[model samples]
Target: MLDARREDLGRMLRAWRMARDPAALPGPVPFRGHRTYLTQLDMALLLGVSERWYRALERGEDRGYAREMIDGVARILALPPRQATALYRGTGHQPPRRPAGGVRPDAALLDLLHQQRRVSWICDQAWDVLAVNAVGARHCPWLARADANVMTWAFSAEARYQLRDWEARWAGSLLGRLRLAWQRWPDNARLDEVVRGVRREPGVAELWERTADTRETSDDAARPMYFPLVAPDPVDVRVAAYGRFGDTALRWLVLTPEDPTVAFP
Candidate 1:
């Protein structure tokens, strides 16, 4: 089984390397003595590892590379979330966790967010806003605030007026998601701070206490929500959240209008 796992890891690494377009790498193409699809040496340079070490891993030598190194390779390869998770598991490591602080959305994710017609934004496990499309910013003005977090916004006095069915729709759901995130990353200090702060808000503590389930559930029905700054008209929108493959903690939240007649300004 161990040998099989190593073989699988090597096969995946080689396939990903071959599939990657050198021009699509996150930054400017390196001044590789020559340019084609990234070569093993180029990958080694990008990963800050000796070519021999990278080659050993790709050859299934099982040299016991550090988790950080594996994660760096995944990032450099721009592996899809699922493929990245598989890489970690094949190497017998826990998948990488979302950073507590905000993270920049990769080019692919950013492009997807921009392509969406609905209000859409991406947040880390701690609910820190990582990126927001123009529609998302227009509809959610608070997201533009410095260091904005979903927990802080949902529990704020402003949310009481903005979000309809505050207890069931926004509060309960947000708390459930937060609870899930906390359970996954109990040691994250920033997450602890956000939880503590939200618990302090009036009435929030009781609501949180009532929420026993931590798993996130889908709510398919469209619900009325008011965006006072952007749209005075009450809009029926459905909130959809998509978790990335490798980084399950990083999620894309999209608000789509149920009523096609109601348009975003």
Candidate 2:
């Protein structure tokens, strides 16, 4: 793809990357100078590709790219509708049949969940629970269901019971992140529905306006929770977060115990 059109693509890619709002970017993006534009290396990490490969692709020196990889870039950069269409067309990859098919849960990602001895789960950018491992299911039974969502769950009575200081720590921060996700994916109907549902809760609509500094990965801090199986009392947990795998459509998270010796229930 080293032709003239390919050269145009390379330039377009560079421009799009520059114009992206780092605040709206879905994944962890390192700050760069004053712009805070996502660097090539950050793009590589989020796409689960080597920096060398991503550089080659950006330069249009790479050929026969996978549709999933380009789609991942589009998602991260929050490309405009026209530009996104052109990017796919330029890459020669067919568009997904349904909007919902755009970012389906990865089976391979789900398989990884089962392999984790600790509580682990896979979700999409919208925080929809696609799959949870046995340990995760046992620990948080609410997460095992098909329609489970992180945003909606945190507002539920179950979450209030399980989480200590549920409103101040968990729900407020999570709602802030959901707003950021919505900024990145305004066209995402599922995520929009999530925001809508979360707002309908008492006082949440007003609360949404105040949390402007949160992101999905902001849940990294140790959270106090009541895990009946783990202990009779509340315990502080460090929830480890990860991004996309080979499929580039999921987020894998594991809730690691603070005590290394603590066994999975």
RMSD of each: 12.4, 15.2
lDDT per residue for candidate 1 within 1-265, as digits (tens), equals 3487788789789988887777655333334444546778877766667899988888877777887578677766767778888888877788756432225567888789877767888887678776677677677766644356788888999877778888777777778877777888887766887899899999987887788876555656677789765467767788888866877657898988887766676
In model 2, where is the ten-residue run with the lowest total lDDT? 24-33
Residue pairs with backbone overlap in model 2: none
Model 2 lDDT vs. the true structure?
0.72
Cα distance off (Å), candidate 1, residue 42: 38
Tell me the deviation in Å of residue 249 in model 1.
3.7
Encode model 2's per-residue lDDT on 112-228: one tens digit a residue: 667888888778877876567778878887665434678788877778889898877777667766787788877777788778888898778777766665755556777888888
* lDDT on C-alpha atoms for all candidate structures: 0.74, 0.72
Candidate 1 structure lDDT = 0.74
**What TM-score, to 2 decimals, does candidate 2 have?**
0.58
Where's the lowest-lDDT run of ten residues in candidate 1? 25-34
